[model samples]
Target chain A: MKFPFTSEQLTKLHARIETPALIVWQPNLEKNIADMQALANRFDAALRPHTKTHKSPLFAQWQLNAGAKGITVAKLSEAEVMAAHGIDDIFIANQITQVQKLKRLRKLHERIHLTVGLDNPRQIDLLRPFFKDASTPLNVRIEIDSGLKRCGVTVGNDLVELAKAVARQPFLRLDGIFTHAGHVYAARSAAQVEAIGKQEGALMAGAKTLLQKNGLRIATVSVGSTPTVPFSVRNPAVNEVRPGNYVFYDAMQIALHAAAPEQVSLFVLSTVVAHPVAGRLVIDAGSKALHTDGAGVTGHFGLPVNIKGKVVRLSEEHGVLELPEESTLRLGDPVLLVPNHACAVANLFDVYYLINEALQIKTVPVEARGKSQ
Target chain B: MKFPFTSEQLTKLHARIETPALIVWQPNLEKNIADMQALANRFDAALRPHTKTHKSPLFAQWQLNAGAKGITVAKLSEAEVMAAHGIDDIFIANQITQVQKLKRLRKLHERIHLTVGLDNPRQIDLLRPFFKDASTPLNVRIEIDSGLKRCGVTVGNDLVELAKAVARQPFLRLDGIFTHAGHVYAARSAAQVEAIGKQEGALMAGAKTLLQKNGLRIATVSVGSTPTVPFSVRNPAVNEVRPGNYVFYDAMQIALHAAAPEQVSLFVLSTVVAHPVAGRLVIDAGSKALHTDGAGVTGHFGLPVNIKGKVVRLSEEHGVLELPEESTLRLGDPVLLVPNHACAVANLFDVYYLINEALQIKTVPVEARGKSQ
Candidate 1:
């Protein structure tokens, strides 16, 4: 992986900063945003980029300014944070079952145009007590099990039943049907990702048809997952696309051929603190900095830019890189590592350094980070 | 994994709180701390518990009150946080090479007794500019490689040379030798863990002797790593032991037979958000909350209490648990999951809920969380 910054530029940046810092190259970041938005435009789909990746309201605002319809979050707390930052239209793409969270969600709905995902009757029952007497009905999207079996209902009878359940509630409005093709991360090749993507689109479209046949007025048909957005958005039946990782792609995106190295804007800047042997070097960034989420997908902890090595091991604060014997990387030398997953890596830091093309840095607070609940 | 809390207590707690939260069972937490301290006392070793596990100064204060000599941190930022909270004595068990961090270290040393780990000459060179002319010498510990292989110098000439280099500097004090046997996490059996623990102790003792023979005084001989602490502290030559995870044992420790189920204190209180299939239940906690650091040590993401199932899959905000067909877990049901590694999980949350035997709760801020700079 080649870094976007030159060695001299990185040297000047590293001179005044600490190690294990998250760097967001602004030029690449803007390009990534524009490129993904252009793709959504070409497919005539609204881009509701997932805020779970950047976790910053500032980044969400940038997406909204660059033609995103709104924003998507994985949890209610994240949505609350984004709403607090004046992001009005938000979609929570995960199930919110706990009563306390539902109460918070109802309060948030009064302040913004909030849409939540629901896959089961239990969730609707839980939400009824809070939304039953509200002036505005809560917009809910029926989640369909496209390929990722972690959540969502199966796209046949289960989908129809869930949509009906939501539609029957006077306080609940069945706004759409959506599915996330997260199984694309497991695809061994680009062709496999494409296959899963197409299947995901078909499943969501089929679910929409099934729901409409059952006299449900579904307004939105959305497909999520960064790797599958290209193929899933191609289905004319889908009106919205939510892809988060494309904002700052990482090693896993590269491994799945979803993104090129130059498109990856996020990096963990670390300093080689230990050269223990002939072929091994240790950096200050470890699991706490880069995260271990995509280890299984990439078969490595992270990829070091401009180096022929792999982050083979990670403790809480140490990353052990296995390098070639003659590698010039020495102690105290700085290395930028593209984490296995950018979303998980973004959650680890309180602030990220946004670097412009001139290498001037600005601090961006990850305001919604760790708002997992 | 058996939860320390009763179902009634958990239900009440879950009713008022959000899901995907971290809970510290106070009774179990106190017991784990006492047990480890008693073990260290039995072997006549000082307990410098690593604060990386809890990341809370209040928890560190409890350990110190329970007869801990000092506290150990993984980074300079952690040490700075601990020091700000009036923790006057801290040993950073990792290298500090960055000039900016070294500058901060110099400032931190003025207010506290700070000792840093050093394994190479480059680190010593980095320190010279800041500590060379200081009135108070900065304490430096020679890091010996006791089979972790991530950081630290070898036990022979490399150790001696690093010691000599530290002693040569006017403002740098060669205070001790330390090693973390993290490789014990890879031990396939109890016997293998025991073997690695013994080797760790022997290597540290041997390195101390080698440095002393070279006319360098080594005051502290410390060994770290939770699973190996019991065996390593038994070595008469070892004077101090640092075991962070013993404060909150998790599934990884249970897998290594280091701690039993009852001793586990920390848990991710997550709600079952989806029951997509008969055998699969998806919880709200995932890699963002529980962390994926110990997935390699334990073949599962986490262990659910009172349930005969494992967390089979983890996305950023969802945990997919594969259970038997007879299981009674349903949507909106609360489940307490013991994470694979408590340290990494602690880093993910900003606050931890400390619950007493009476089922009362108090929030403890993870003061040093995200201080990984």
Candidate 2:
């Protein structure tokens, strides 16, 4: 388990670097990436992993290098950052409504293979002009709400109408139908996660059949989420799967049985900066590094694990570790905090740590740490 | 009001600048700084503004330039950044415990007039060696918990004990008693906010009396939050006040009656990127930008404002807008959304909108947006 950078280097770097700095582990990251890539290979589906998780240009390169079909971005800025980093194939997984962002999208389309996810017929009309002007028509994917009732066209006739509407646009090419089983993250076990995944894939595949019968060309059937992927591959209709958080699973992922403890790739490395009371020791990391979130409960936001200690409360900049014994913890020790959700935690910092299993520092950047605008 | 940069220049700069860019509004920022300065001056207290709000050297310069006696930071990195910017006076308002951080604190003490807050007696031991090494001993303030029962020495006698402990340390100076009425943000009205402020001031003053009776010299008595200042200034015992969010008040600040609408200096300038339904238009800003926390509500996170049009709901990266039926929001119109909690929103992005009253784009770089790390 020899790491790229020695422990002495990390200690030295720690001295030079400021406290509350983000420290991402490199070995865990590569392992997580390999695991997801293997799952994609097993499914025989295109691995268009979403880039919104890390948001670092360096992480995007890793995903591309890992044999992903393309990148999926939630915003135009994210896509633009990836594009600037020379990532050409991108899918704006959410709808594009803003004219200013649409202009950016059209500009992006001029040079890259840009596709957008659409949930409504009006959205199709909105993108029609850009489709007509492009040298090649922009690819459109109707996002079906399989079970997660957040965004997307509800399964059934509504989805059919949206797909047929896509066919009506002469310049718009209907690439496929996509669905995200976001609800699968709440699954209690692998069995429940698989069930949700199958349902999600079936719904998207069903939408594709309806569209094909309605004289619309369906090229891809996409469905995914970290929790749903294992079960989803069983459905042959799903051509591609997109799972973002699998690369850096968090406390929620573990609680939902999506990933094991060893599979988690990210942790907020913090130091115990203050011992204000007999039982309480405050760490350097706070809401800013760990974003305000806790899994399975309210009030307990970030998951503070005792690397060798236990954290009880988190203030804006200090994490309070409450212990049973007064002398259990020392003043200058570094602590590892597994955040409730990794995606939001990744969004909190400009950079991340790339340490190994032996806690050795490696290549620091994970590519897409702040790809969001 | 005139801005430093024209809209066209801003647009061009935004287009040409690096991807993952952070844009800030200079004029709006100046207004925020000036307003806070006037309030601090009106109260006749030494304004030691919290630098944690905007952890940029440039903004720290603005506060110092506007007549702040000192800049307050929550971590060593923030203090280091401020020190590099030539900010000599700094107060690490949170407790410092880790030996590594104490080592850095000793180094920081050499260049700047540094003071740190401590609540428990255990912290005294951690600071003892660091202060002994520095030519000038480290100034330690006893933080009293004035209703925000998160961190601090809550009891009066405990404060005295901590002060006595500080006095006993060869390297520690017993500065005074300080507390933040963080619960003031939960207050519903101006009167309630003022009452919390006065209560906080009285509690600190009470702790000061306890320390004074113990034969310890308490030089500074401080208590404040953005909500309590106007109310707490009436208490003559308080000598210094540190309030961070006053510079860029948010919708929550407004809802708490802490600030007027015009006094709010920062807003998330996003675009209406998608229109899925006639009433439902989505903006580019989502949970990552506006934050997931609303003022006591679950789904309601940020302020839904009329930009060029209207916004209703905000998802992760998509803000759903409920516009008038007769009107149509095109693909690319930019909208200014005033976030619910400016402090949390500031933590999300790397930059902000430095704007004029007419909503024209100006020089944008609230550089310390992610200085929390």
Candidate 3:
């Protein structure tokens, strides 16, 4: 009861598995992984999850073992971590720059079928040398900037031009054109997200067509995020979907109708440390645990869900509660908190508690917790 | 350069530090610590740094060795971690709650002197049992809500009544009053923050006088926050100042003019991992490395400066640089990004590199990184 693990097991591994440790609920994670696997199978599309969510090689293995075709990583470091864990197929979904990274890519190319996403022609030229010596060459994809306005080349000839350049890279292989309908996150409703997903699929398909008409062979069209997966996975043009948070959805994901609340597998288990003042109760967990990720503008500071019994208000280090004017919260009560955004919160710690529906606990390593490089 | 420790060192020890690690600039931290030490010396007031910024036991040891009277913890878990690291004098700056946490607090009490901040009568009742057997009761300070609107009881007769209630509890000791003018964080200018600091000091002093008039001994009047410290330190009525971020000022703190950019001791060191496309470069660091704690209205993303020597948009693990219309980023470039908020970013990492001013690296443990209890 004192630590996350059972007292019997805790005593045996007391020194290594320290308290203030990130406890993983394995059963919950297994359920989350199974649910996502079911969705990908139902849609008949590859679930190449973006590993940035949990950044765990173990979780990536779980996903692949659960029938995912490949794993998506946002950084080369994440790919490296995954590679070390024996994940051979990696999709570096973000733009890659710098010769150092290219060298690493070149090395990885020798070991795995490596694909990098790009939004510009210069990147194709930059990657030429890394692939020049390789027999299979590097796989490249042109990323289209669909309404998010964050990255990627905007629609039309600009995207087409980028794609052509990718095809022209002497040692690079132009596999496909991809776009993440990131704006789907701001969807007003689930209906809007689905509509946005359709538009996103069309946009990628349109870009692929433009490239094909210009005499380029586009092998795949990919578009997906946890929010858009439910809407985009069934699209015929899209061969793969990368929805990371689906494995452990959070409150914002639920609000977006990405998953039902019960489907959320991750939570912050906190203890009430102090009730120094009435109307304000402080919990042992703070921003360090719950994180300052304001996924959606909920009136409360964090996503407050009824976990077992307590209604908690998350503060920086203390989840404050405006105790009922009549009721009181004593010190040492444990409360469960579901965060607003699972992805960001998941990245905050080195491990997580894999708890079952019955609340049985298991520890799992967040193998990719710090794989930002 | 590949591992946090040097190749020679890592080879010698066979210890693998996590990669894409959050490396702290150590000599820079020492300078920052010394500067704050000088500040406290100049003002002749005790410096009790809030440990929420760099929750590292190693750093806490450095601060205490350099002459911080005590460590100020925002939560009980942090206090517990610091205590584990031999930091005996601690002040829980926030209210405490949860029964399990109280038990931990009781366990901690057997070892160190603790002062907990409180604002209401019910909190007094909760602490009575813990203090019942004490020869010298645990100290409690009433927190005055001064415009931050986060926590603390608003100053006035209610505060006086609360202090009186504490006086009535035989097991509780009314230490004094404290207020954190967090509103100063949004100050447009130093003059504004200074003025706010004056108002905060007046409120703390006024509350103390009111408590004293009502037969409660006013032992300490503390008013502090990095933004208010420069001004509030001059207030004679304020016996203590708790400014944690000053030890490693951040971009937001610098923007608020609380500290100059040079005073910023901490920064996230990231590598240019990929240049997938021109006009868009990705760094190994993103929301996970430099947390997405943006300056809400100021639009500061808090990235360590220059991703490929240019500003970039951050995705989870990759920072997407939107280069100037004609800019070019080559592969393998290293960039420095000063996060907008250092505290949250620091909290995300398990260990950090301590680099000298010349950028020579010294490794240190972020011992308290995941101490969320």
Candidate 4:
């Protein structure tokens, strides 16, 4: 495999950077962040970039330092990591239940300006015992189902009831309405993404008005996900966008027409270990690195831009590349690939080798990786 | 959602056991080890259980202690972790090339009885320089394609050519021949798995005999992959079988009919965080926890046993479950799921909470996880 940077740039990197490594192209990553922040600014939305994508406290801090309002995490473990790193404004965009998890949440909430997403009264009831005596009220955004059938209330009586239930708890603050337009990732074109985004902003805005009319105040109406960001933020209804993958747009984003090749930031650096046949090569990076998630748009596992070949398939530890005929690639050649999903790939790695705009390399442990809880 | 264990069993477990966890049923795991060991004993085939399934040094030591001849790993990083844990014999059942990696192989070889898999001559030349003045020769097994056309030689003249080239290097020892019957996972029944196994054993035996007659001495005729272990290990001609997932059979094995549900040893312990609507539930475990790969055999992502539901789909952190009608499951209810592929799921977690037969909880870090390099 070749160094993604120039020979001179490679010379500046600390020796011993190897293949099957997650290399975060910081220049591109910073640009992606700047561009996303600009998008949020254009639409007068507060940017709370999701830390779930990078799962790195350092990266999240970079976004926060760059004017992001806060960060969104999917798990309590992730929020714990961010909070440990002094990221005070943390929103867990997932339900938290279980007596044990609620205790942890209550404790963490006491430390930060924590806002959790809640859809059902059962979760609220579970947290009641812990929150009942909480000195600081736990804030919650009503997770409403916009279009994605994955989670959230369906913006009706259920939404109204949950909002009221959350409001009923003296220790719980009914903050705002939140919805994730995840279905936008499945959209075929940019126009479709825009349509889904419009629906999302309208849905969240509608939920806010509905809840407010019912005497529950809503503060932050948040819409996020990389694919829906550009479109959703454009709508007048959204005030906050929480696009995590924008920190590292992957092949999935490119396939969805949500990102350009130049904007794709993270790459799985691999080394061709075997040239089993003339044109077919096997790289050390496999499903564990590139991940097995479908390339949402391209149908390929990953795209190796430097080589004129495609990562066709992946076993647990072997990436099979069907190279172009008459290719000059050989054994030990460094191949770089943009993965299908940046979030999944990030979770698969324990640490990421950060390559600066100047291509100097350093390593940072993926602090919240495998923090799925 | 329901727990895999009975109420009595759950009562005996550690009070703080959490969700979205990788729990190793140590009793079942030990039993699986004994059963597979019995299979190896029946035919006098030495067991070289692949460590790729667990990627845990602690687990690999258990296999080695259970009378495994050696341990097989998928990557050098995995081998390094195993070797660090005092596993002297390691067979990296994958090709290794590249100047940097070859140097690492040479260095690691100096410490252990390491054997790497190779298919071509260029790899030999690359190692030739490093091993030219080595204290101990680098042992290599020729990898032949049994059925999985992913790697290895075609097993005729190509095998002979590669073997002869490996032997030509004073630093390389063409010790054994290896093949992985990964396609056995696609078998429709135990009989189909046997057929694939028969083909694999016959092919490896045939290749060994052909190579010996062609003037190269060969030892260690190895075959592996958990699905073919039962049938393939029965072949007396095979000396070493490296099936790793037998330590923890999952839904994929159950669908292959290679394992019974009672034989399943690992479970992704999760919690029903959201009952989005009636009968439908969302678990805190998503693709990052349960993963998104189909069961390869049944097209199912994961099967939650005591709970009558399929983990229908997964986002990054939300597993959408389609529960049975009139189910009494609620928020905070524990769910235990047998993943489609245990190996993939294991890699997704930082540690496995070992629940012994007595139902005590202890954590063992997945030592080699994310060691993709």
Candidate 5:
């Protein structure tokens, strides 16, 4: 991973740039994209990476430039924002059920190579009318439950029936089968994560094979999960991999052994606001600035890299750090924290302070910050 | 607690309205405001309600109009936003340490009744230079540690020294003393909360007496915490009470018995996007919409009051609900969730859907949504 700005750049802008800012180290971010793409290329899988973690069309373009074929979004609102920013090949990883949302999706479907995750044929029935009069047929990917147990049809007859129903619809094209190995996050080791990834790939590839045997054309088999991406991409039958969190690996990734301390690209820059009592120092970064994804396995909400401390708890605007018995970090000292979950931390801020090697400062809006709908 | 929209209102816009939207039923909001104001009046305390919870200037105005003497904010950013909306009586309930922030605070102090919390004499030493030549002397409140070991000086020599230093400064008007009884959130019983509230009032009152005996005339004795407000306001010594979360009583409040079910005025509106499993269904709302405050006591991350299910887990954009064995909730069904923590949930959204008794729908931007800096 690329290091942050040099001492020269830090001199010019470090003190002036506001505290509680989302500092996106440009070099590390670019390195993260390059590393993930390299891994995907080595496995011969098309990197259709998830954009929900970054939620930036600018970053999405960088990923595309690095050989990503398409981008995946979790919400229609996210799809709307990314596509409007000239992101062409998009896949919404969640099902849209509202008629109004379906209408919005139809308008978007006419503009890009859009495929939506659908598990229920009833939803296909709803989409039938909207897509029947469309210029471009909406690609429908049946989301099969590999292990996450969140969304998606279970892998047996239910999966086959959903695909058949989509194939029967003239407007709804059966484009692919997809599965998310999100449960890999709970795995105790990289070996455990690999096992989950293999299951995820098998689930998607096997579903595709099952559909093709039933005389249905299945064009793609996609699987993704940041922790499982390394193994999932290696599956020859898996054509597309969509891991979003690889762009800014966080404390959780480090705990899962998916990344090293040097690989964490994002850090929330905060200042020690108050040294209230013994064993704890309050910082400006709180639940609003950082992610409360809980203290993973380390029992530290975040690693305050600049200070020898662990954020033990947070209020709205205060991070209570449990420091070493005699640590000398004082009030107003600039501190940096690598949050437990980078995506949630990114969503909390409106803009990011992009710091490059030469110390050039760039401010960019978190384009899809609240596009959760 | 006001009932959310009538059947007619939900019918008219239920399908058209997007998921993960903050639904502010104005009737309940108005009722909640009036009730809090009444409670404050019953105790003859100034309802200087903290505006950090619902960081909306519009809601702050409502609180002021309903007899709130002033408003409290946790950050300079929050005060800036509230002041821009013509909110005059603003007390920043946190310390300002940075020279830039102090300069900005000085500028803001010129235009409003701004008081800030400070605990350290070193901070006063820093402030002395900035406020040496001021138009209106800055009101300074020495934040004292009541029970929560967060910010604030301890109750003895440290607290006395800070207050005396403030009183001695020519340009720093020693406003009073403030203590946040935030630890009442850990109370499992009303008696425990009441015990914490009594201690909060005693600590502030006792500190004021000790300071006055030392020739420091204390004007305001303030205590604020949502969980302790019910009892804290009843203490005659606490002249100013600043409970921020009363405007939207959440699941935690209901569990604490600080609020009734009918008093919860705010909720998140979401729709069931998929019913892909046997016992669980997914809503379009996720960690971004609801809070990750964890289960208070009920073990329910969120209470979907409008639906017969509990939100068991959340992904970035999906709330997986555990439905009863034979539930009738279907795909495309509208659901309302009362988040465990209201402040965190409110900060996540950009806008709120205001539905009043008249069924007239109005959209207002969550002005302080990303003003966390």
Candidate 6:
């Protein structure tokens, strides 16, 4: 998963395309995809790679071609985009409560084998009317709060109650349980991430058992998140793994010890547009290109792959890099930056300039980019 | 500038459209535009409304119809989009160093009156090869570092040298000098913002004077930024202002005392999708919809307009709102959140839902949404 381009190759490639562009090193991307799928195979779990990272149907198709059971999306709009692109199996890893969106989901479920996450009874109530009396029952996976505290219910009475509520609706089939260990990104060490992952697997598996004892049949047990997938997938009770950021391990992944720096496949090709001082260089890619997600976690906007500098500040269209005093970076020079969070960064671009091992370049549309509805 | 919808109106509108949508109150938007225009009129300066905020050519047209002399953009791609939409007058308030983008800029200049910002001799050199022998000179504005150290040359011998270098190129017209006091966003008080604004105006005017003493004819002297516009426009030497964020004031502007809470025009209409805990409610709008810009400055992701809660954390598709103990927000309820930074939030969506005073809604495309190249 090492960066496949040399300095000369990168400079030549950089000259061919526009700055502030998303560049995917094809070899590294394919390797990362293969490595994650192999990991799922080693654990004997279904590899359902999350499309929320790349947001490209082409990349999702690549994952599926490499033996992914299904694709995972965060929004119904993204699922629709993937379904239109012939991705039949999708699991929306987030909750959908609105009736308007539920109607769209019902329409989408007619074509694809869809499964949505639900953590509350109210969401089941919202789905009942729209899905009721349909020829095919919609699949529902109860979300267990496995240390992320963002979404999902705790693995207790709340979990059993939510599962029972989904089971009560004849049109809504209680599929299984899923948990995303998002808090592992904030883990201080690998050991901490392992602990959270172990707890995540245990909680979801335990929740599955608890619901089964309550006369609810749960088919699939899933655990996800890039950082925690290695440890979480060890549980035999878990049948599916959905790790999104593994496709393009970012600076945050490196900080979490979940990935090596060379494994990062995604880069924002930015040109040094301004050298206002001896130690300050400004790149054309700013928050608009790199995003502001990982700066809070990493304390830096992005990591420069080719230069001895740190992206210290970001405006709308300007990324200010603070270079070492002896650095030789100048104006108009290309700087490849590995964004702190690849998922958020991928959402900003309309297309990705993919470079193969032969240094050949091609453009691929980020089909699901801005599909945030 | 008050939000132009009642509770019933908002409830009805929220039900009609999908959640996690960008909503613009039309009355507040129009009033914000007119108020900024009036402020520019009071100072006898031409209002070149920066279209980087709305990224919509229709909004730029509204500003032009309301007496704006031109539109300002941060990228040449944005200028091309605005030009394609018939916004003939444009100033790219950023430096372009790549030859490819410069060629695009040159072609765009042929179709309209185009000006670009310049800070160093390298940019002047980048422009020389493209505009050395053109039908008309490309308008170049020397950027002076007012207070924000992100970009621009200092108002010293460096400024004189940069301006002289621009004047040396016969094909590059030295039309003006400009500076943006972006550091005013960090001002702790209104007085500090006013002080930064005064220094911004004085430095630009001094640069103009120094350049004129060096035998260069500088037609325009400009200073901008939403917070400093009120104080910066008062300087008589400044003839043009480019304030973008005044179009949709957000939580950051309110924190800087530049905007009242009611003057905020933009909102993200999100539905409560998950109530995992008693005090925690998860909304559909996350960093993907609301953006992560203002979270660093305000210590909150976004301010919930209708709900008495703070969006404490945000994932890619979920916003975690921590509400009061007595809060009654439930699943399926719609909450309007004012983003921390409206410009960043606007970049995330392809279209904005504009709601008029009569509760009518229309979709407007963000024409230059991802024109970051």
TM-score of each: 0.98, 0.87, 0.83, 0.97, 0.97, 0.98
Top model by DockQ, which number? 1
The residue-by-residue lDDT of candidate 6 on B1-373, one tens digit each, is 3445666777898889898999999898999999999999998999998889999999999999999999999998898898988889899999898878888988998899988998889887788888887999999898888878999988778888878888888898889898898988778888998899888888888888888899989999978899988988888899999999999899999888889999999999999888888888999998899898877567799998877879998888999999876468678888888899999999999999998878888999998999899
lDDT minimum window of 10 residues, candidate 6 chain A = A1-10
Q: Pick the candidate with the highest lDDT.
A: 1
A1-373 in candidate 2: lDDT tens per residue? 1223344554465664555666666777887888888888897898888778778777777888988899888877788878888999999898776444567778999989988888767676667666676778888898877765556777678877877777777778889988788767556776887788878877777777777787878888887688788788668888788888888887778777777776676777776665556776677777677766543332355555443235555557766666666655556555566777777777777667576566555545534444454
Stronger candidate by lDDT (2 vs 4): 4
For model 4, the docking class works out as: medium
Q: Return the TM-score for candidate 2, rounded to 2 decimals.
A: 0.87
Q: Where does model 3 exceed 4 Å of error?
A: A1-32, A103-114, A124-136, A154-173, A271-286, A295-300, A307-315, A318-335, B1-31, B124-139, B154-175, B269-284, B303-313, B320-332
Badly placed stretches (over 4 Å) of model 1 are: none
Error of 4 at B71 (Å): 0.7
- Assess the local accuracy of residue A330 in candidate 4 as a C-alpha lDDT between 0 and 100: 69
Candidate 6's docking class is high
| Model 6 alpha-carbon drift over 4 Å, by segment | A1-3, B1-3
Q: What does candidate 3's lDDT look like per residue over B1-373, in tens digits?
A: 0122333442222122223456565656788787777787787778888888888888888888998898888767789888987889999887665444566677777789899888667666667676688777778888888877556777777787888888887777778888888777668887898899888878877777777777778878887788888777777778788888877777788778777766666766555554444565556666777766645523655543433234445556656555655344344445555777777887777677775545455676666665565
Could you give me the TM-score of model 4 versus the true structure? Answer: 0.97
Q: What does candidate 5's lDDT look like per residue over B78-194, in tens digits?
A: 899999999988999987876678888888988998999888877877687788899879998889988788899878887777777788788999989998988888888889988
lDDT of 3 by residue, A1-373 (tens): 0123353443333223333334455665788788778887897777888888887887888889999999888877778888997889999987766555677888888998788887767666667777777888788877877777665777677776777766666687888877788777677788998898888877776777777888888887888688887667676777778888877777677677777766666666655554545565555555666665554433344443432233344434555555556333355444455677677777777676555545555667777765565
Task: Report the candidate with higher DockQ, 1 versus 2.
Answer: 1
Q: How do all the candidates rank in terms of DockQ, highest first?
A: 1, 6, 5, 4, 2, 3
Q: Give model 1's DockQ, 2 decimals.
A: 0.82
Where is model 4 more than 4 Å wrong at Cα? A1-15, B1-4, B11-15
Residue-level lDDT for A330 in candidate 3: 50
